[model samples]
Target: MSAPVVSVDATPVRAIALILIGMACISVNDMLIKLLSGGYPLHQMVFIRSVIGIMAASVFVWLEGGWRILKTERPGLHLIRALLIVSANMIYFAGLSVLPLGLATALFFVAPLFITLLAIPVLGEAVGRHRITALFIGFTGVAVMMLPATDWSDIPRAALLLPVIAAACYAGMQVMTRKLGAKSAASAMAIYIQLAFIVVSCVSYFAVGHGRYAEGLDSESLIFLLRAWVWPAPEDIWKFAVLGAMSAIIGYCLSAAYRLGNAATVASYEYAALPMAIMLGWIVFAERPGWIMLLGTALIAGAGLYVFARERHRAAPGEVPGPAAERPLRRG
Candidate 1:
């Protein structure tokens, strides 16, 4: 008997599943950071995590034909992509330490909008009426999410902007990743990104962490950013390793998902992170998002879905796939 055949159409389903599971892993990683932010400096956490992540990523790179798979012609592009991912990580964590996980994750939802906008100019992808409309609706969602509420006085002003900025940086990284996906190995991309994180974390530790902030700088965000490093307890070493392993997993899954599916389809599935973040926030931190936030999330999801549908419609049978969909994953 012949083995059952898998349809090519199932690629999207596999991509979506990979992305959703990846997001969940990321949320769990975020939860660990949020839990630990009160005690350790952000750079310290990142330094340790990246060290572990590099080790993990290196093993994967080795297993994928012993580092030979990492050869790349576009070293400059890889460096830029690495910087984007590292910057996004710092900004998002800065906001996350203060903002509720759900809200911070919600704000990062604007990444799809940024990605769509970037693609038009950077990749020369065409945008039609439907995508234009989707962009407007998505921005409206961002506006709704950012509007000051009656309780707004309780939240720091900087907290509101950081995650959105992070989202933009992340979107740029995603676009660049897709552009490079055709030639770059997934392990190579991840290894480069992790190395970037390590370099940035070391620089940050020497630059910002050497000078201790005055006492009583206790706002969650400020403390996370400015606190002097503390030596990790023996048990904490294990926790940091786990965090790094999760980061490695996140990098692999995200790279694979984009490599396998169209960017629009993969990006829309990113919204799945919001709900996972919300649940984790509620259970772990007692965060309850207001009704207004829920409305904003709904708008963002609807707009993203519309964009996904439009992208699918634009792809006609037998026509060439765009840059995003054209990249086939190369095996070593």
Candidate 2:
């Protein structure tokens, strides 16, 4: 009468490598989205990306066994999971448009901490003193990142909360991924995510496609959020296409990584996204991280990794109930 345990491979080398690839793809996708934010609406980009992503994900569904593979026993959970991630993306991308790329991504890295805390309540899991200490350290890192060294002067105060809130939603979606459904194909879950994205983006278009509602907002983040859709530049079509493709790949890989790898082991590898964000920011945006930012990054990544190490050390043999991120095929 219980749900099946996640599919976990003992040596998930392929899963780890695949998720690292997914992290890299996500970092690149985040950069491109930040680049495009100045000229386009978030919803517009999401809409385009989803359209293309659904098409790409459809190929995956087909490969899995035609469209029937998309069917699921838990449509409601799928719907909730999809909306959580869509909200996460919209918030994170809007913040990315204004915040430094490295800092924003680093902030989002606190998602693991959110997972630990969420697991306690939602999964009825207990948090030990060690993880409690880890939480304290993890949050201190967040405060460090928020210091003036990161240049809070130009940032809209509200924008500072965006990634953190996004992180919470992302964490919630992932927690549910572990608890929800009767275990479906990665392709099926992926298709559900893309379809949810499609529906949300269409609703956004109807709500604010013309920018008439954005008449007075001056914050760059708000502008990015409320901006009207303009046709993609001929040259930028490729970026949207790439984002769509990468979005699909990121979702599929994250699902596979969590499914195949020990949740504790695989969760540690997810930190790879922090460094990828830093490297890509340096290369593409020329954003330099000061020592303060570096310290913040170290604390966030270290705290998260340490949590996994502890989980591995203390848990009983067999499958450990570690955090598994599905992005929920979610986040940018």
User: In order, what lDDT does every prediction score?
Assistant: 0.74, 0.79
Winner by lDDT: 2
**Candidate 1: lDDT of 163?**
83
- Model 2's alpha-carbon lDDT is 0.79
lDDT (C-alpha) at residue 153 in model 2 = 63
Model 2, range 116-230, lDDT digits (tens) per residue? 8888888888788988888888889988877765455677667877998998888988788776644667767677778888898899889888898787888888788778889
The per-prediction CA RMSD against the true structure, in angstroms, equals 5.0, 2.5
lDDT of 2 at 214: 82
Model 1 regions lying over 4 Å from their true place: 1-13, 150-152, 176-182, 213-219, 317-332
Cα miss at 161, model 2 (Å)?
1.3
TM per prediction: 0.87, 0.93
